[model samples]
Target: MTIRFPTLSFAAVRAELLARREIALLDVREEDPFAQAHPLWAANLPLSKLELEAWRRIPRRDTLIVLYGDHAGSDLAPIAAQRLAELGYTRVHVLEGGLDGWREAGGELFRDVNVPSKAFGELVEHERHTPSLSAQEVKALIDAKADVVVLDARRFDEYQTMSIPTATSVPGAELVLRVRALAPDPATQVIVNCAGRTRSIIGTQSLVNAGIPNPVAALRNGTIGWKLAGQALDHEASRRAPEAGEANRAVARASAQEVAQRAGVKCIALDAIESLEAPDRTVYRFDVRTPEEYEAGHLPHFASAPGGQLVQETDHQAPVCGARIVLADDDGVRAPMTASWLAQMGWEVYVVEDHPTSARQVRGAAAPVHPDAPVVDEVSVTELARHLRESPGTTAVIDVTAGVNHARRHIPGAWFAIRAQLAQAIEAIQPARRYVLTCGSSLLARFAAKDLRSLLKARGSEAEVSVLAGGNAAWFAAGEPEESGWKNVATPATDRYRRPYEGTDAPAEAMQAYLDWEFGLVAQLAADGTHHFHVI
Candidate 1:
């Protein structure tokens, strides 16, 4: 039987996605293009890995799925819908012309999945929603020392390179999750700002809609607006957010504990970890550190897997759910935090006991290295660069560093690949060639190179892999030209990850209270609205 699929113009598709609840918007573009920018609800599940990687995350056989690709000649749209149908998904649709169509329809894009512009548009449409002080008003607030929290919702790197004075980088998606962490004082009003209108509006309203107890508003037009208002931006700070108070710290500690208990997770010393490798059991040893750290030197047999995401999505990370998962970290920060969360997520998680000075030295002299590990040769790198400069087939470079370093300066062609998204991020890449992995430091670049090489080999590809000898730091140190045209790409997600207790339909009273808290955005809640909130 011929399948007659649903088709809609980009405008119609987006309207349906935004107006409806629980829609899955899938972008079949290769990772680089997807990273360039996309809609908030859209997720990148490349057409290549549609059959393999997307199954577990997108299990619904009848999801209201919308697929798109580059407007040019990419067949990803129909192909993806076809694949989803084969996987038993009954309702599959495609955006007529991909993002180009959206742009043609004057639709805006965002940097991260956390902020939904359509939702923001809804907020702006309401009578009660007021624009925060314009750039002029904000500058006055800064001048008057007003009690407002101005948050930069861009990546941390952008915040570090240039940002409004006293601004904090609370990445957009994390805005709601980390709201309490950012604004502990109930009396402090919150202001969300991004580079432009879309993220600022979306970021602000997302916090409001998520039931944050703060009077929330967007920076009018964002940083650009601030600049046009003749405001001077600040740059290069070594300062970090001060440690939270005892109460907040306690919450973090407790959250970690809950995560650990739920996941059946534990932390073990290096020696204890050493005893568990039964040789036959497929124990996955992951190094939850930056690629630079991993490459410079990592524990023997340890593959690079950064921490933030390891905890957030454990199942996608540790496929062997019951396998003895061992993590390696140079310091306790990520390892413990990650282990605690993994435990909460139902994993048998553990951290290697202390014995090595650095993550690299954890393995003894006899640890086996994957046979096809990438080689970090200077000669090979020079040849690769020349090849890139010459014919220039699509080549992608990732700069995995703190937001500050990346914003200040990064490799010319590298896109943002923070360590957190390493494993899932790879699916965004085309399976054609081995990647040129890079980071701020050579350690991570080397680690990424090896990891990518191993991944390719496992897939039966003989792709050549290499790492920049010194990463982006070296690229800058060598006097390469640095440009300021880095474009923020849109990242999309599924409603599947959102956990609201009870059911898909939130209680109207609870939702009313939630809207009230988020709408007025009073920093602290009185006894009235607190009852409806339950952490899922």
Candidate 2:
């Protein structure tokens, strides 16, 4: 039975959005290709991992979902629509002309992930006139050893990769929390930067909004601008801002709380969060602290969503656009600062005020336990290696790691498979007496093994299933040899997409084109008046 998906035109989709309707504009492609171009509100829900992530991202099965892709004679959109139907989505449609159709309809297409928030940041700067300093001016200040502190507003890993000569890693959300300790003197000029313009502008504005005492400015266009200006960047920089003293923490907390209050962000008690979780409403509880801190201990029912990344990738984290968001942090500073921006971005956001030590806590990978997880059997890496050596053709080894990780390295004989396409993948493989599943950390592998066992059982097959304990990490730690590249793939390698601006091998023209697209986002925002952004 062939299913024909209903198609929605670009004009109709735009009308639905402008009318404040609840619709999920899903770009059913891998992140890399999706990053090349997409509409501002389009969320990347790659068909490869749809089964694993669909239920969590789009919680309401009845929600309106319009799927699109490159669609140059490809079945990606139709296949994705079928998958959504299988998952019980009631209102799913395919975009009429796909990406090309939208482009022809005079719609604005943006490059890179999180285009909506990034474009909004650009719009904010255009409206608010966020202050900035050129790379050359910053370099002159560094040479003269002026009273200035350079704060890299990107993630720690990005700052470590490449940074200004004397910049300290103080990610965007931390600027309000840690700036006072880094610069006690009121006269010390502060500069914030990221890989590009968005984070730099937002970070500088965050401090400015909080009424910080010191003069602050963004490194105009950030590292890309520095490279364009021919300024040398230091690699593997380890400098970081110091922790705040008690007095400074008090001051920062007061300032951030005031800013959040002005932005219409609410502060809620732990007990009050439950009332917000009724069936009629969707509420996301997040710990907006660093990953390390969240792992040590965090309140139960809260997912670890580092503040800066959460703000940068809100669509990915909380796909339910109109849902209420509650942020938590042990220190009072981060949540309020993050919530302030989210409120301005038009989210009904809140911060957790009092910390409760009585709540249960979990550690490490934070994998959600499946109800039938205990039924799956487990095998150690050494045992799997021995089984492969003793009975090569009888046992099938499937690596369910992310596509990019599998491409970099994997067990020599394992076939790469997407967890969502388990049944199709198993059918494609030669029938075997036994199967072993593994991923980067084995958390997802356990879930996959349970699913595969149930599927094989329903089919009346005698195949046994087990997960490799500790997964690929244990395989490497056990001194086992591995292979690299996209050979022996059980499914298409489309699970992961390659970014156009990722590595040095990318064409210079593509990189410049991406920048040019970003430069014109303000105009596009004006054309599409759906974004409800208010600059504070």
Candidate 3:
């Protein structure tokens, strides 16, 4: 059978970017390779999880999309195009020359994930001249016990890992609304920091843009700057900002609204939001509030997307560029402040005007993306454990989870395999009489088991293939034995991309290189004129 995919040329894609038209340029390769070098706006949607992720990240089925990848002679881009068509995506095409074609066409490529937002941050600082104090200057004030407060703008977990001494976790979107309450005295100087440059610059500028009375500055280069300066950091820091009082809310609300207006963010109501649900257009509804506040209660239709992270990870959250976004916030401050950033990033963004006070329609975490699970035989955790212990070597356990998680821990002697390469992974392991597949909760394993069963059938082998009833999570709960480290790997561990700025794994040299790359983003943004970013 002939498998033909419509192709989009690099020149055409570049034209769309330059025109500021809605286009989602996707790379259908594993994240590791995709992160190495791709066009500025390209989002990684690996073919392995295309079905699992495409419908959600791209809520609009008819969105204009162009895909490219290093197919390794596998024709992955065409396969992805067909898959998208089956999922009801109307306008899908393969990139004519893929990555090489992009380079040949004089297209600018960017490294690392979330390049758009990071580059926009540099542009914001360049245009607005956002204020900053070097790590040395910030340390001097702290050592002197001067009138200053350090607010870490990264996520709480990242802050808990390692943070500046006496720094509190108050993520980006919360900065504008919570700053006044956190530092009531106008005399106190406020400093913001993140894992790297983007959030710190955005967070500090948010306060400055909102016209907060306190003096503010970003910790230059963020925690990386602190580490390079040879200063010790605090681990397991639990300090956080308190909720804003009514007086502070009033001030934050008014300030945020003005900033949103300046950035061209729109105010929308429920009826207007419903009208956007037309068949031809895609609209994303995100509640840009704290997860804890959202988990307590949120509108049934809205997903929990904290404002700061949404701006940082727009590619991950809203992969479809140019899609309309409606943000919901009960406080009337966080959503507008978040919307302001989105507006500046060339998005048609809005904040709900009549956000519900009693947002009790849904509770707990955002509902997991619901895809039809393929039915397969199941083995209970206790049964698998008994077989592995009493009758060792009879059954081979294949854990179909993220490589990082599998390396951290798995059933004793289990082999880690990327589901996309399950056939090759199965062949690499010593031939087994039976196979049991498991993931964090068996959700993904269920799908992999179905594929494994068909592979065995095609080979005329009657090997039994079953999904572990509760997956890895259930096994640990049952006190099943486990082991760490990689063994008998079929494919390279390229599923997850390790950020150079994250954890202590990256060396000082790599950290310096990351900072150097950030410092040059303004120039790159100029070379690739698709980004319609500006600052007030």
Each candidate's number of clashing pairs is 28, 0, 0
lDDT of 3 at 484: 90
Segments of candidate 3 deviating more than 4 angstroms: 71-73
Model 1, 214-257: lDDT tens digits are 77888875666666556777876333344445565455444543
lDDT of 2 by residue, 84-151 (tens): 89788888999988999998998887777887788878988988899999989999999999999999
Candidate 1 vs candidate 2, lDDT winner: 2
Best by TM-score: 3
For model 3, how big is the CA root-mean-square deviation? 1.7
Off by over 4 Å in 1: 1-25, 30-42, 46-131, 146-149, 171-190, 197-217, 248-536
Predicted structure with the largest lDDT when compared to the true one:
3
Error of 3 at 408 (Å): 2.0
Per-residue lDDT for 32-100 in model 3, tens only? 888889999999998778778888788777788999877556657876888788788889999998889
**TM-score of candidate 2 versus the correct structure, residues matched by position:** 0.83
Candidate 2 off by > 4 Å: 1-12, 69-72, 78-91, 96-106, 355-365, 369-400, 413-438, 441-471, 485-511
